[model samples]
Target: MNYMKNKRVTRKKEKHIKILYIIPSKTPTGPHIAILNMAIGISKNLKMKIFIITPKSFELNYKNYYEKLRESASIYEVSFKKQGILYWLSLAIKAFKLALSKHIDIIHTASLKILIPLGVICKLIPAKLILSLEGNPLYEMFEFSLFNRMIIILNWVIGMRLVDLILPCSKWLKSEMAQYPFLQDKLSFLHNPIDFERFQNAKPRGIRQEIGVPEKAPMILTVGRLHPVKDIETFLKAAEKTVKHHKNAWFVIVGDGPLRKNLENITKQLKISKHVVFTGFRHDVERFMAAADIYVMTSVYEPFGLVVAEAMAAGKPVIVTNVGGMPEIVGDAGLTVDARDVDALAEAMLKLLKDEELRRKLGEKARERIEKSFSAESVGERLVQIYGSLLKDERQ
Candidate 1:
């Protein structure tokens, strides 16, 4: 009886694992939000103690998320106007000190910039370093200048080799990373989690009325920055053809970027300016998802489209480009068309718009997919299992 009682006590003592999440972004983007969501999920579903470190601007810009995060983890805010070398050095030093002071078991981050420096620091301590592959770093470097691209590549090479484990957000990303022989052993796929409750409970805020679309008009929505990689041009081209078949259909683009003016000009050229509404960046995306009859994503490259999952959680049928992880996210629940194929995109949109029964069925399946496989609790449980197995191997 005493041996059994002692075993229970030992198990109870081993339950808590100290984890520190370092987020380098000052602004709230999809990847940052995804990491924060996972942190919150880890705290809720495990006996783990969570710590988060980010720039002060992040806390200020994402007040609601900060508040939600604070309830689950301890937050350490730093000041940085720009992400220079000194800023990264300061962050690494801060993280190193905090990890030691708190006895952090694992240090996780989504930034390669953070991973390379922190990798050196983790060697001085007992903590394991984890890098979350939120996007394809190599592909993203094409947008930068030649000098900056080389610098980013150097970071990727060093960071990929230094981290103990690499968690890609999708199987497609894992396959991409596996091309590197060194990363083959460390790769694991972890899908980004959606706040199922938030999306499921979202109520329509009359976005259609505010945008001047009739109440009964079929509203097709796509949410992403107006960037070339997002392939918003293809969405517009498809919108042009889709409107020809269903003149009453409205296409709403819910983000802004460098390509806004060019995209608007294309709409004018196609004479479908009246059918497309660019709603800039919106915080009430769930509401917009609620108001939308269909959700579409046309990215030529995406690691994992969190917005697509959010839309699915909101019970909206999705149509995504057959690139990266989007087809994986949509699975059999919705349609997948070849990237840059305007006719295929238009046909998919028209099919969903024309058949209310098919849309309803797809929407139902989409929600079921999210609930069964990608909920916060499920993700948190998977994370805990990974941590446990890693630590167990270390002990053995």
Candidate 2:
């Protein structure tokens, strides 16, 4: 008992900021990637200690990445089954105990579901609750399943009541939440940061030759999950039109999803298989982006297009749909087209392909915009300000 008391006293005196980061999984998906980057940045830039809290269902691969992260932080696994009242009750109990025992100063969640109960539980203990709203809760819920819609609404209500801070990835997302009167003053816009230096240093070499394209072939590249929202079918159909005129040009779609076979079948049916290459889930996206002449994003809805910013950072001209946050991210650096119009997309791709000077001008502008707003250092500074604001509020 005396030893335990002395340990608690020592911890309180040290007063290290203990942040418990909760995420759904450790996958290479969007939310996971964004949170992992933030955690790494914070660990390197600040003196605070971070503890990653993930569900037991999450796989523990990528030891190399985790080892680097663990050098300055710690990790814990908690089981959180997404079903039944009993499961939720158990999860709440476990999380509450972890927060209390670990002396967690901040409860930070990347997943939307954890925000409600986790925030409430922490607030009862008076721990700070910080939610990184990476995507739109309402839109993402409806996109996944109707069941999620109910959960999203419930969580949104509780989140507004309990969360101390809201971090949105884009202005569009912040505007969307502003429609809800409850979230007005609580919302803060912070776009996910990109390692601009790494992207800028990437060399565009050998990819055209390895992918079997002609040395001078202009390649249009789209890198993302092959989902319906991504509207890759539109890009593929547009490629059919593009290839009819630009015979030496090629369209490369990198990344994978449930729709791979469907997209492959469409390529065969369109008879443009020879002009298109579906390189499923290449880990070397930087290498692919380096080789590509143009980067395209046709997502019908994107909370924030990380890859679009990455492309601009790489000094590649971009073509994206004029929806969600794409236009804001691209600014005047790239072309925007109607999401569903095949001919329009085809025209933009072809226009950039033929106009080398136009591409160079756009690419230069794109890099400049990213340098001003989307660099990792800029994002880190914004986040630290948010954390300081929350800390100030708590003291008062």
Candidate 3:
């Protein structure tokens, strides 16, 4: 734990738990969204202060999309080199200075890359460190390349073990971490909180009509970054099958990433481009969900599909791949199908699209489940308890 280059507690005068959430990106990705929601809810309910440590370039988007949350929570735009050794050195120096100057009570990191430096710095000052695992890095590494695998191992060996708490979003992901003996006792499965009220109140009539899809069309929706891991190609193929019989059917994918061009090519090649609409990336995802009759997450693997919860909150019948923590999120409220099985995914989508009564019934059930289990209020309260306990223990 004492592997820091520099660390010191200058002014230990903060009244509340000062948590610094370290993350890589500030885009509208799930992890960033989760952190913002958690910060907003927790700040309102608990006497805690949060400082989000992110790149300076990310501030514009953060200000535009999350100004309200930022007003309540502090944001430290740290300048770091984009890559190589300088990035590591810059992050370490800035983190140490921020922690000491701000009298940060706890270092709560959400990115694996920063865990080592943060954990080591925490040990130098001997501050409590909490590491939240957002994705199964080992699986991602295996799915990617050897170099990535080494990075995953390094995180586990150096970062995960040193952290005081292991907050995993999914039990499935926690099980992956269980292989490490040091992390077993420190682990806690905390579901990512969703702002249900926002989605519940949002109406999508304008967005639906603007998208040019008939209001009566049985719209099937999926929202996430366009990537191979999302298995958008499979969803496009499944949409092809679904539209064959239901001519008024439509599939709306509402995000953009590297795989957009390839997925578009597949849609064109399948000759189903007319039935599928790629909205690139949109800020109004909840509205899109409201406009749709059914939601589907065809990810080959997802740590926890936050969009699935958002869809359920929007009161839309959902069909998600039975992968990662999605099955737990889906529970019995929505349908689950094997990932990569185009026929099965298509069948599930069609069933939801075709049955109006069933769709409504399932959507109602989905909303009930989210209200009971995944609301931001409930999640924030739980996190506050954990933070309080950790801070108390540190004081003792």
Number of the top-ranking candidate, with lDDT as the measure = 1
- Measured over all alpha carbons after superposition, the RMSD of each candidate to the real structure, in angstroms, is 4.4, 4.0, 3.6
Q: After superposition, how far is residue 396 of candidate 3 from its true place, in Å?
A: 3.2
TM-score of each: 0.93, 0.85, 0.89
Which scores better on TM-score, 2 or 3? 3
Q: How does model 2 score by TM-score? A: 0.85
lDDT of 2: 0.79
Clash totals, every prediction: 0, 0, 0
Candidate 3: count of backbone clashes, pairs at least 3 residues apart or interchain: 0
Clashing pairs for predicted structure model 1, backbone only: none
- Number of clashing residue pairs, candidate 1: 0
In angstroms, how far off is 325's CA in candidate 3?
0.5
- Candidates arranged by lDDT, highest first: 1, 3, 2
Residue-level lDDT tens digits of model 2 in 1-396: 664455445545654667777765545566766666667667766647788765564445434347557687677665645545655566667778888777776877766766778877776655788777767777677666667677778887776678877878889989988887888878887788776876777876687777777768888899999999999999999999998889888889999999999999999999988888888887568888888899999999888999999899999999999998889999889999988989999999999988999999999999888878887667766666666666654443
**lDDT to native, each model:** 0.85, 0.79, 0.80
For residues 1-396, write the lDDT of model 1, one tens digit per residue: 664454334544565788889988887787777778788678775568999889988667877678777777888877778888788888988998898777677898888766677888776765688888887788788888897777778878786777888899999999998888878999888898888888988998787788787788899999988898999999999999999889999999999999999999999999998888999998888888999999999999998999999999999999999999988888999999999999999999999999999999999999999988887767878988887776666443
Best by TM-score: 1
TM match of model 1 to true structure: 0.93
